[model samples]
Target: MGEMRAAVLFLWIQCTSGWMHPKCQIYDSGEDLGHFLKWTCNYLPRHAEHYTAACEDVTAIEEDLLGLPPNINTFCISMANGQNRSMSLGFFSQFQDLEYLYIDGCFTQILPTGNIHLPNLQHMYLIVKWGMGSGCCNCHIGPHTFRNLVNLCDLTIQGYRLTAMAPDVFHGMTQLQRFIISEPCVEDLSEILCRIMNIKSLIELKIKAPEIQTLNQSNCSILNTKESMKPVFNNLASADFSFGEIPHIEEGALAWLQNLTGLSGAFSQEVLLRLPLSGIQQIQYFSCSGSNEIDIERICNVVFLLSIKKIHLANANMRSLSMSSVELCTGLEYMYLGGLGSIHPSPHLKWNFITSLKNLNRLNIDFLRDKNPEICSFQKQPITWLTKLTLLINIQILFAKQFSCLVTLQYLDLTQNLISNIEDFAFMGLTNLESLDITQNKITQINANTFFGLHSLTWLDLRNNPLIHNIEAMSFTHLTSLKQVFLGQVNNPLTEPVIKLNLTLIFGGILSQLTHLYISSAMRPKGYMGQRVQAG
Candidate 1:
């Protein structure tokens, strides 16, 4: 029968070139459209998820000029400029149901040749282009290059001058669980910490390779073994070399990751005043930053580890942080110290070490270069399991019960704090505050008990106050669960000067649970705001 008419003309050219129909018919010529590779191919009117193929002057990559769509499962190959060829992803083995894979720019090598089996590869990114050819140290990693991605699970590798890699280049990823390497002139990390310490299903590990200056005792001697030795990262919990400049880290180079519990790096006040507190006594989320002046009582006796609970110190200038130095941590529950420089305002901030943190819940104190006036007293800091408070402190005034001990504050950020005055019951015992951000302040007027006892306030941000020119029409009538408001201004509309907000007598009866009302068509809105649209 003439071979059944050649199998019905090969299924009619695989259903109109869609290779058996997964919805595909896009051959775009979008982008610049000049020096070759300027491409595009978007199609999804019934299946096919994710397929980029962005190109521009790319030197080599030819899978029939990327006629993608084999049931695409996320695949992006963006490139701009190329040379040191050796590319050969074996045409991705015809996208056998591929799974997330992104490759960007200037590659000098990436040869997953031959039988490139991908068994549903799971997440893989490779971003190059750092000082070009031979600068990212010839960007090569071909020891079986990802050995047929046997279920690879999350693997990122950004090059900024890579070096010392190739320990069988992640042999046959046994389901690697999150492994990131953002190189910054990769300066030897002892063969990448002895090849991901034999990745025992690695669970989160970030390495920023900042010139890897040092980690003493002669390159972490295989993490100073012994103690029965069996610790191949039994599901490594979290490790971030904190973008190394490695001041010093000897004492058992990270106490054999005994189930390490989240730890960041870059600490140098002489390494937290001689840190080695048994190598982070079972750390429990500890981030650190440095630039000097950090003696917060010897880093609170070395990270007050009783399985500490979250403490992120930034830039480290921490002036006079005394209250017996964080009153023995008390299993802190999230605390971020700050610094942007200019500090000399510690007038009084002894909220009795947060009333001995009975499990304090979230508190960020950023001193955006404190420009003077600083006194935030809470008498007996009533952290009733505080919910979330961010203060960019410089403070001008918020007197009357300034945050009445945050009666369960649920998110409050005093952005760019220079507040001009929010006295009368200033949020008196916040009846469960639900998001309030006093953006860029120096307020001029919005009184009517200035949001007294915010009855479960629901989002309000007085944006960039170019000295608000009065707004007291029952100033948000006890915000009956107000729903979104951001009176915007100040980004130099010619040095700002415009105010006419009368949203029906300032949301007369809470304006029917107002659903988002952002101002700033040069702050103009005098009444009638029925169905959105009140000014430019």
Candidate 2:
């Protein structure tokens, strides 16, 4: 009895002396200090307190304070400098609130394979960057790795070089909604693709696997669906690839994308086969560059782009526009075709393409100067059928062609191509043209009657074009409705020598309406000097 009393007294002194400095293992920096302290008390390590009582104290907090009802919701194990990094499976089973877990740095391979049964973890982020460790093996089985994340809604796994997930990485994650993989060197994105093949309920998945600097070269195989399972992803809404790139899925692999109402990408002509929509009903905005290749009919009907309001197809080798290509698109309002390969009008091509588009108000056709050095597919009748239009034509180098009759055209974009010489008959029948943009082109000369029939022309943008050497005194004389003129390239050396408007004779009153005059950089300054000489 005396010895027992002395032991209790000794423990009392130790607990009082050493309990002040608590060692908390798992924590979020964003948590408040008081909350962290409260949590720390539950996970704190005791240095000396009649070890049994210390353990009892921890259990009391785990049960009473954490309110853990024998269900593990979280687990955290620290890795010391020299200790083996694998935590015991018993440690994981001790707490009922073990839904989330984190193991820092590297880990041993033999920690415990197929040892997890966590069904409650809805959001998880694993930060592992292991090397050739002895605790794990080249996994090739099911009910393993991420075996029991069945109810997991969000899972994030990150590492420098995680070779590959177990074949059944997401074997039973039936209710999983979001999955994220941030390993830069996830050379085996295909493995992950296969794992999620059956997760039809997953709505959002983001994959990001760029080349990691520290990883060695690795080979990955093309993904294939399981033979017995014709899994359909009817519920998926959005997917983001690891590197903003994906292997072009086979012909019908993207039949599932039909349900996705919104998609965002800079894909161009060659990758059009990736969008395999069989019955999409609500897609609207599309963006692409020169390399995208998608079928116009497939995109319009099956991809359900009737809801699309804006389209940007620049430099996409688009030579002709067919009426059926845009038949079902009722919501299309703005269209951009600049950077398109062909600029010349192919009269032999169909002209009724834009005639059916009732909602189209803005149309842009950029020059081919950047790729072909000249415009080759500019058809005038393509613009004539569209009853109302805001046109933007950009011709970099000079090429003379008679403008087709476009009576309903409004705003015109003629910027950054080869239009150095302006012909009097170029814009003859454009009666409703309100704005003309010939910026950043090769315009070195102009005729007095260049814009003869443009009675409604209000704005002419000659900015960034070498305009000083091109403007004749009569170039601006006729357009009585011209209100705004943007001339002179920003920082042009000649703009310093010539500031006053010299073309007052072409049409004197037309120059007086010029209220918004911008010379490169006024309210905003395009700081760099353009290489082309504007005959300054």
lDDT of each: 0.63, 0.48
What TM-score should be assigned to candidate 1? Answer: 0.35
Clash count, candidate 1 = 0
What does the lDDT come to for candidate 2?
0.48
Model 1 score (lDDT): 0.63
State the lDDT at 414 in candidate 2.
Answer: 58
Q: Give lDDT tens digits, candidate 2, residues 1-536.
A: 55554221111122322222122222222222233223323352222211211111121122222322243244333333222333333334444345555443343432322455554445555544244342322222233445455556876665523444444446656777887766535444444555566676788877666532111111123333342333345677776542434434344443444433344444533444345422344455555553444445544543243366667665343443567776765467766655433543322233345565667776665433332222224343445434344323433333233444456677666554556666665777778888887776766556677777788889888777654444557677678788887776533244454333344564566666777756553222345443442322
Stretches > 4 Å off in candidate 2: 1-243, 248-262, 266-280, 288-309, 314-332, 337-352, 355-359, 366-404, 470-474, 489-507, 518-536
Q: On residues 1-536, what C-alpha lDDT tens digit does candidate 1 reach at each position?
A: 45554221222142322232122222222222223223321321112353333333445566223555555564555555544465776677677766766666656667774676878768877777433554453566656577677788888887634443454556566788899887646555654665556666888988777667555432424434322232346676777655545577666555555334565667777765555543445667777775655666566666574355787887645565656777667677888887635544343454456666668789898864443322236355466887998877677787776677668879988888788878777678889989999988889778888887888888999988875766777778768998999988622122334334667686788877889887665433344232222321
Which pairs clash (backbone N, Cα, C closer than 3 Å) in model 1? Answer: none
